[model samples]
Target: MLLISAAPAAAQDTGLNGMSRDQWLPTTVASDAPLPDDATLDTDDCRYDAELPSAFDADALRTSETAAVITVERPGPGGEGMDTCGTVAADGVDLPERLSLGSYVLYDVDSGEVLAAKDPYGLYRPASVIKILLVMIALDDLDMDELVPVTAEMANVDGSKVGVGPDGKYTARQLLQGLVMNSGNDAALALAGALGGTDTTVDRMQELANSLGAVATTVTTVNGLDTPDVQTTAYDLAQIYRAAFQREDVRTLLSTETATFPGYGEYPEFQIASDNGMLYDYPGALGGKTGFTDNARHTFAAAAQRDGRTLGVVMLNSTIAAGRLWSQAESVLDAGFDATSDTSVGTLTGGSTGEDAGPDAASAASAAPTESSLSSSTTPLVIAGLGVVTVLLAGAWRLSRRRS
Candidate 1:
């Protein structure tokens, strides 16, 4: 018989000194280190035999069969953190800046390098910005050509609407027009109900966002109507914006300044004009979503391309007196493209617009939000709590008599 010695189970308790055996020494019995406080650890932070999920799995809840997964690291110190956001915006003062308030981000489509960002991870009500995720979920699950009959609930949508009255059936394409061009809340509800044959599309939105590493965000309504749970961080919104913008349909809808969707009776073929001001003034300005609620304030996302370069911009809960988000996005986009004109970091070499460098260049930026600089009304209280932690830590260190 072969001699066998049974291994001990892992320790779960912390010692008197406030360190577990696993904590006092790195748990070498397992190959992986404990997950940081920021992450949701599986297997008790041990390297289990099974594979563990990543901190953020952008590809997990994809709605499309062919959707590819992309992951961008969170912003932090020594990590790809918020400092990156501040530096990029600060670099481009010479350009005609447009953003008035809130967080913003821009990145290279090929290099995955953030060209410019401001307050990327600041949390704010996304308003209709949440529609980006809803639209993606619909695209992922249903075909673009599929028709969804407008329901009474969809028709009764409160905020910005495309005016699809009860039982006025629309093809998925038409609904998408309402969603992208008009930022129609009614279109959002219709899309959500159509996605799963029910009104719970907000849950699907949350699942997709969670998969994309937007840990602090949640969605309670398809239209971003005022609800306690309907909120997202700047980083989360950027990620969703990036995902939606990847589709060809989304791109077309965004760039259009005026659209003539077939209208209802006696409406005389109503014509819709885009609310985004940058589309008219800014070069290569692809339009995006705009939103506002009592809780969310002003929010917007815009994508622009020039000389084979593309950038996405988002702003949330900006100073109300500062003006609209489209103008802000234009300013940020100008700064980003302007920066490319300079030779500071990795600059794009000569490449004509006709030649495609393949899909790699187009998918370059991360969806992660920048570090939050804006303080909430409750932030001061949180700071006071931290001060208490510092005092406690100091006292504990003195009691232990450990002096470095």
Candidate 2:
């Protein structure tokens, strides 16, 4: 369990620890340590029986169909008593009750604290959330205003699209807006081509992931289309998004609710609206990404600020409900904001041994909201099955339309 330090006398007396305004923040966890018994660090479905030979095997990941099932060592242990991964201390913030999610992490951007988490290191499909990485790499290498010619290959992508035609010409900025605001796979392909081909773009994304110490992440597709080998952990997702959030352009593009794409050549003018629901509903929502695939399920990454503190949340393999992701993210952020000054949870560790352990490992242990309490509830399972079915049916409908 995370440790909660009692507020100062004035705060205790007034029942208001003005943590929102105070500049003196607690020290972030700096080393690997065992987490409290209640922390949700492991799950039967996501753990590996033995440590991996390497943090990541890019060659194996690219060639193997069963590679997604292989789990790598994460910073923290699975739960209270497990010692496979070291433990860390954390304030016992109650997770939302009965929230059905596969893996999640909640992180404080400013304090570098993991407020709460569940299977934070577990690998799951990132879906469109992977586009965050694509956008990051693009911003680093490509000019935002440079016009990219939409090729036939880009226009033919199967998932969410912004309708850029084969002959369409769009600026990198417009394509980015489409990629993020509209969750456009076509935009992703276009951007990838602009940075070279899909192969080169994915290579750069993998390099970026490795450099960030996101060793568990493997990129098989630039747009996060459900590929057999593509996978990423919630911890990695948080890290990727945090890095992207630091850039003014990426932040602006993500927070944008609407954009107008002027028709170029053969492409017709069209207006696109953001698919991320949190921007409209959650106050202080900076930006977020949402994704789904037949295999990836529902994935969401979002951040919000309150009382001068900003928090980021990542949910992977979540259930499909109209607003569940937003509500869950809001709940986590609310709990983080409500935490007292003395709330010290276990630190997220860098898995590197000896001297190789750098700030990345210590600061990278991601967090996510867990069930405040566990109970034998059959309803969530049923709902999850239904959600999968809905997704499959939606995919079938899309396939049918394409065939027609």
Candidate 3:
């Protein structure tokens, strides 16, 4: 019996042994960076660590090398304040310890082993990487060939746009391409409309998040624009990407270098190339999403295959102050690949980390996504054939023992 529980909106825990609730979910931290236009939103206040230690040299690694002081807006490599304070690392593995990143998680996608991480659970605004989730549902439920007309509302969405307007009709696939290739808020809005409006779309996104074991994420926007309540962790992002990348279609769409998007109204058809720099600059790049908002700073999710191994990296609350987002991501990826030791800080777990919805919480989470396009891991958690068996689970998700 595949007995799963209902996941609530709140996260279960951040995995840190000691800290105040506000440290993980601070309500009063003000932004040192300028807010987006006139919008009101939550800020991390440049708080990168939760009293944790990093893998890099504590003495040599400073946010700035020569400057007397570094600010969050322009934090330098090994910036003092920007360290994630994460302690997770592969035993005796060397890392690109100089990269300036707030928090990141590097993991083996094929094996689900978290090779290394820095403040992996640090919470920050998920800028556009949330689009990966939006497209996941669109790809699952909406027909790619279906034609969707652009609305002016979609065209006028506040952030980045892939140029959808009222005058043109686009296939679902085209809108999705714009969403992925251009980080188009317009495409996101259009796709949400096609999937039964913003409310339904956000609901489905949250459901998928809960189903994916992404306890640290809470969805509030179709595009990853920051809202006070909208947030995610690097760890949760890795989980999100793991589930999303399993779809062969999502992989092909993200890997696309350039795609032609139809122009609506007065705009002419234009080409939208992959905005993620890693796709062009890094070898074995599997393609991923990039996002930025004044508050979010920078967030990235991408993976690559090298030496017969596939690895994914998720960087959150990052800034160009240290190194470029992709550059830091590349460095972390390299560090993860450098580990010859089998030691892992943590391993990705099956989804369904929540209170018992009815019963059988363990049984429900044991089963991975069953979609034909989605592949399940053969990782010990046996994938039972379709059947109807009622399982009585004894432990709740929080009470159950699980890998990080």
Candidate 4:
């Protein structure tokens, strides 16, 4: 839903495509003592067992919270998008490099166990993939049958469009389908209007981000367009994606290859093919979202099930300089599926130690109201009054298209 706590960006450290060495890893909070700045934190004695290095340690993270492996050293200089995933593992199993450029994560959706990651908590601009979050909030708040009148402003919105003219109107269900299947900004606009304007919509989205423990995510636009403050992390994306996939309706939306969207006014109904390629190309691809911007490059979050294991992956600041963004994810998933889910680098929900998550006491979950108390003080009026549902959401890749 938004970005903050500016990262250190030095010239030599900036990436070929704009990623920088600073990596957006926040280091401290008000209360706890700063953890020792070390390249790797050994988790052999923690709740999960894995050896991965996060450039920085957070005071807010408990020992178990640190179990979520955030980064690994880049094996070598990988171009903006060169096949950073590399080749077969030592055992000849196809998997991603221990260190790949940019930020990406692979995890078991059912258990929220992180399998593999590179900069999993590195905050970066999310772009269009944020709509997946918007839908999660929308599904719970908006009445599916409610018709939202379109506006010329919506049709004229910059970026991608599902072509809804001022004279055309759509049910919340229809607009959501367009938003997911086509990565339509116009649909997001109309939906935002239905939700009571962008400001209110984003506030709700942020609240949802808080509930799901996506602390790094900050929603600036309901449509997931590029904005200076938009941000999210690979780790948080997995959390949001897992929550969204829990709903059967969302599973269908993510998997649907194409759908008929109503045309407004003089426009005729049109077919909107899914902008995400993984659904068609990857065997177990259930559904996911894609995003892009010159700054964001390529950001993706999707889920697939193999051998009954439902796994989700989130990649940020990815690019064609490597390979098709989807293929990069495939390599990550390939490595993930081959690994045992029993042991994790970290978890999606709370710490495995069954204790507090540490110093960052201001996480949205604590800063904001959750499903357990929608009627409480911090809950949004629209959401609270509905006595509604809950969702976790995420996505993006720009196909002349595409946030929370």
lDDT of 1 by residue, 200-226 (tens): 676777776765446456676777765
* 1-404 per-residue lDDT for model 4 (tens digits): 11211233332354332334343232222233433332222222321112212212221122552324333233311212211332212222246433223667677778776666665555566777778868766665666667888888887887767678788768777787778777788889889888889898888777767666675577778877655455676666777777776655566666766555778667888656667778756888888887765456567888888998898888775543335567667877877788743555556662211111212323422332223322122122332343322111112233332211
Writing each residue's lDDT as its tens digit, candidate 3 over 260-316 gives 578766778865566676765688888899887645656789998889888998887
lDDT by residue for model 2 over 162-211, one digit each (tens)? 77887777887778878887788888999988888999888877876665
In model 4, which runs have C-alpha deviations exceeding 4 angstroms?
1-94, 97-101, 350-404
Candidate lDDT (C-alpha), each:
0.52, 0.59, 0.62, 0.58
TM-score of candidate 3 relative to the true fold: 0.68
Q: Which model, 1 or 3, shows the larger TM-score?
A: 3
Better of 3 and 4 by TM-score: 3
**Please, what is the TM-score per model?**
0.61, 0.68, 0.68, 0.65
Model 1 CA lDDT for position 118: 52
RMSD of each: 20.2, 17.7, 17.5, 14.6
In model 2, what lDDT does residue 206 have?
82
Between candidates 1 and 2, the one scoring higher on lDDT is: 2
Q: Score candidate 1 by TM-score against the native.
A: 0.61
Name the regions of candidate 2 deviating beyond 4 angstroms.
1-70, 74-89, 264-267, 341-344, 348-404
Give the Å shift of residue 371 in candidate 4.
21
Q: What's the CA error at residue 185 for candidate 3, in Å?
A: 0.4
What's the candidate order when arranged by decreasing lDDT?
A: 3, 2, 4, 1
